[model samples]
Target: MKRGEAILVPLGAMIAGLLVFGLFCAALGLNPLAVYASIYKAGFGSWYSWQNTLVRASPLLLCGLCTAIPARAGMIVIGNEGAVVAGGLGAATVGLATLSLPPVLSLTIMALSAMVCGGIWIAFGAALQHYRGVSAVISGLLLNYLAVALMNQLIEGPLRDPSSFNSPASYPLTPDHRLAYFAGTHIHHGLIFGAVACVLAWFLIDRTTFGFAMKIAGGNVRAARLAGLPVGRLVVIAGFLGGACAGLAGMIEVAAVHGRANESLNAGYGYSGILVAFLARQNPLVIVLVSLLTGGLLASGGVLQREHDLPDATIAVLQGILFLFILLSDTLYGRLPFFRSRTPEPKPHAIAA
Candidate 1:
């Protein structure tokens, strides 16, 4: 698709989604405009709301990258939610273990451990796809279930902090281990990390030889192999790098927000990330903007429930409608005249004979 059409497709899909949502609201005897107003107010009307949106966007940005990167290699990895939990669990364990260490060192350990664990979690699916010929989608999904179950068992069993009896969570990190917030805002440095990761991912995918190879592999694996590309390695590395970003997100969530691993760590950022990636058309840079937009939508859920007397499921319905439209819009890409390649007419016969 042409760049202009690529951009327009998602916008058009979003418009259609909003129309559907409005129709649904009207059917439910509610004012769609009023619900939309509440969404805007809760998401962007004030500095506080902006902060809330950005805070939610932080992890979403990374989780979007988790799926976006591997997508370049034509791999569908949907297990990032599990990777996030695994990463958070790793970070919490490391943070507590390294309590006596210097802040920088402890934080480094926590971040590394989280990334490694998360990377491993998703890489397993990639390996299965390459080596065992298993479907990545199936493996990735099953892995998510396993990760969630494992996280619950650990936190509620061996890893549970006695003091957190009510929550059944790991012990909180020491104050020094926690990430500091930006001045006077609920936003933490995790936002910076997410932004940087997206930028770096953009550069890696758009400017690096490895990224070029991965794109080639994605486009045509047999051709890439004939061209001497390490297709298998590229696929695995893409999955690993994607998961690493997710892991970093988990680390930030635990170290900056929750200060430990808990059920709250499974905040659906991973699942929402898939939508963000699709909306962005898998562009790393665009993922950041899309994440913020989706984050705002998610942030408004509470306001939708409280102010409009709507159920919490309202957001899910909207998201589902949006996702449905996006899928439909995919077929519109090359079919649009704006996206179709133009061919110059053949030159007139020289000098009219």
Candidate 2:
């Protein structure tokens, strides 16, 4: 695909999605224009709204990486939810255990533990794909359910804090250990972490020899093997990097937003990230922009419900529609006349000759 098509196709699909959503809303007797205006105002019109969008985007950036990275290695791993859950569990376990240690050392340990746990979680799926010829997609989907079940068991049993009553949760981190916000804003340092991760990931995937190898492998595994590229190793490494990003996202939720690991850690950021990755065509830098847009859409959910008497799942429906449109638009690649290369016809002088 041409660079211009890369940008324009997704943008055009998004606009189509909005138009379809508007029709859906109009069918329900809601003014589509008012609904759109409300979404804009609630998501990006004010400083407060921007903060909310950024907060939501932070985790999405990392989660989107979970899918984006492995895609370069020709793996369709969708276990980001599993990786996030595992990371959260790892972070909470370490955080509770190191309560007596210095804040810096403890936080570092927690972060490392989260990354390791998450990497292992997703890497397992890649290992299955490489060794057993199992489908990464199936393994990843199953792993997501398994991770959620494991987390529920641990949080409700062994890791449950005695003080927690209504909701099951692990011990909370101390104020000093929790992630601090930007000077005067609700936005936490996790946003910076996410942004940095995206940049580093982009560099790794777009500007490195390793990335080129992965691209070659992804394009043709048989050719990659003939060329002596370690396709298995590349697959595992990509899975690990992707899962590590997701794990860090889980850690951020514990340290910055939730203050502990619980059901809240299972919020659909992982799934939403799959959408973000697809929308951005798995480009890390593009993922950042897509995350922000998705975050804005999510941030407006509450306002949509409150102002229009729409259900809480209204945003979800819109997301589903958008995803469908994006998938459909994929068929247009190389098929669109504007994006296709023009072939010059042979001159008539040949006939005269």
TM-score of predicted structure 1: 0.95
User: Over 4 Å off in model 2, which ranges?
Assistant: 343-353
**Compared with the true structure, what per-residue lDDT tens digits does model 1 show for residues 24-77?**
999999999998899889988999999999999999999999999999998988
lDDT of 2 by residue, 33-52 (tens): 99999899988999999999
Task: State the weakest 10-residue window (summed lDDT) of model 2.
Answer: 339-348
Clashes of 2: 0
Evaluate residue 223 in candidate 1 and report its C-alpha lDDT on the 0 to 100 scale: 98
lDDT of each: 0.90, 0.92
Q: Estimated TM-score per prediction?
A: 0.95, 0.96
Q: Clash pairs of candidate 1?
A: none
Clashing pairs in 2: none
Cα error of candidate 1 at position 241, Å: 0.2
lDDT of 1: 0.90
C-alpha lDDT of residue 206 in model 2: 92
